[model samples]
Target: MTFSADYLLDRIRLKRRLRIWQGIGILAICAALLALAARFDVFGHGDHIARLWVEGIIRDDVARDEMIAELKRDPKVKAVIVRINSPGGSVVGGEALYRNLRDLANEKPVVAVMGEVAASAGYMTALAADYIVAREGTITGSIGVLMQSANVKGLMEKIGVKPVIIKSAPLKAAPNPMEDLTPQSRKATEAVILDMFDMFQSMVMERRNLSKAEVSRLADGRIYTGRQAKNARLIDETGSEAAALAWLKREKKVPSTLEVIDAIYGEEDLWAGAQSAIAKSFFDKTLISKGLSLDGLISVWQPELK
Candidate 1:
């Protein structure tokens, strides 16, 4: 009886060792697969066209420039489709993205498809594309610049608080919230807005092939439906992603059989997820603070406060 018991105990120990080894082997295989996917972009692989999404507010660090850089490097990507759904944001951010997309267009065919609300700076970015497509109900075309300031003197007085600001010149901080805007300060601010507005006008006229008078008529800081914009010659066609893809194949000669890859940057694994979350949080905070203050110029459309 003792000998039989000893043999059974030894067998159980051997089985446990095999189970552990099997688990380790499985883990090793999974790690190897993930490594391979990263090296080759296997999970997000495509042969010809690269689809990039430009959603939310247009920001500097939303992986847009990085994605364009990647597309420039990859020779296999024959064309690009930029999908936009935004109300617009900072002027500089929009300008940077617009220029980058234009640079990419010089290399390969680039198409911009507007989603629900691509206005202001969002429309600016779309101008960089070789062809622009919009849905019939898509809201677009707020071709203007805006500068705003708040007078909080009453609120400060009510709260028993006084804040003082020192600047190099009266015009340096022309639109301060703590004081009433002087006529001189207001004029200075208006001049800055006019300069930016002229730039915006020029870009639209040059890109959309509209005359100065035509652009002047459209640059009233008013939003338009896609049908209205198409009639006004601001956008090329009214359609969805499928129509955009069809244009790629029919006009640009990109193969329909080629896989369409979403080439947005920072779409890796868990580490990428955490990084994107942190970056998004920072962007949100910055946008909110900027919205509350009037420190800079914006190419955004602010709807009426009800």
Candidate 2:
């Protein structure tokens, strides 16, 4: 009987220790999850305004789309400010970002704050917002589409080198660098550019409430200052981000006390930044070698040289 009692006590003690350790493990996991949720702002602690920044060339849409989706899912995010600073890039990239922002605007008031240069597709992105604000000297409109190709046939001939291309159709590789663009190929390319240009123009006219004649007058691939854009009705106001926030508070009735959080998507940690920097160097070199070919139509601003 004594032996049995001793054995039972030992078992009880072991079970108690096991239960304590298991509880600690579960608590550790819960704490880890809570920390992660806090880091990601998953807990709705306070009302906040999301600031989604579009800087440099608008190349890829993945990060921006993810950020937009996150903001959309967050109930604490009452409004959004889209800050744009870019000369623009691929038409498809810009269009995708614009649509994502538009979708976000459906749930919250979205205002655009233009930085130094928001031309081409950058300006198109601003059109997705409820209102646009820009600095007086901010460069804004370059409403057009452009397609360019280099012909290296003469260079190859001079170098006694030729590139042979095999295609099922004559226009399969039309406007190739190894040959001069045929009249048919040029016409086909122009048609594609014009179609993209028309889409851009229509979006601008519809968003800015500009007449077709007004759009025709301004959409000649011309860059405009912020003041000029406002005068032309391309932008709503000539101001900075503060003006945008004020507009949100007064017009949209967003609370002035709400916290503004930058929700821009990209690398956040030092290790990630280092990795991205290394990768970006290679990617930039590739783009330069390929003449920045985005493999589709582009809405980019290239200033004409006299």
For all candidates in order, the CA lDDT equals 0.82, 0.83
**Total clashes for model 2:** 0
lDDT per residue for candidate 2 within 57-86, as digits (tens), equals: 777667668879888988889999998988
Which candidate comes out best when scored by lDDT?
Answer: 2
Runs in model 2 deviating more than 4 A are 1-39, 42-45, 268-293, 304-306
lDDT of 1: 0.82
Per-residue lDDT value at 304 in model 2: 63
Residues 224-302, candidate 1: write the lDDT tens digits. 9999999999999999988888999999898888777656365566444333433433533353424422236777765
Q: Which candidate leads in TM-score? A: 2
Q: In model 1, what are the clashing residue pairs, if there are any?
A: none
TM-score of 1: 0.79
TM-score of each: 0.79, 0.79
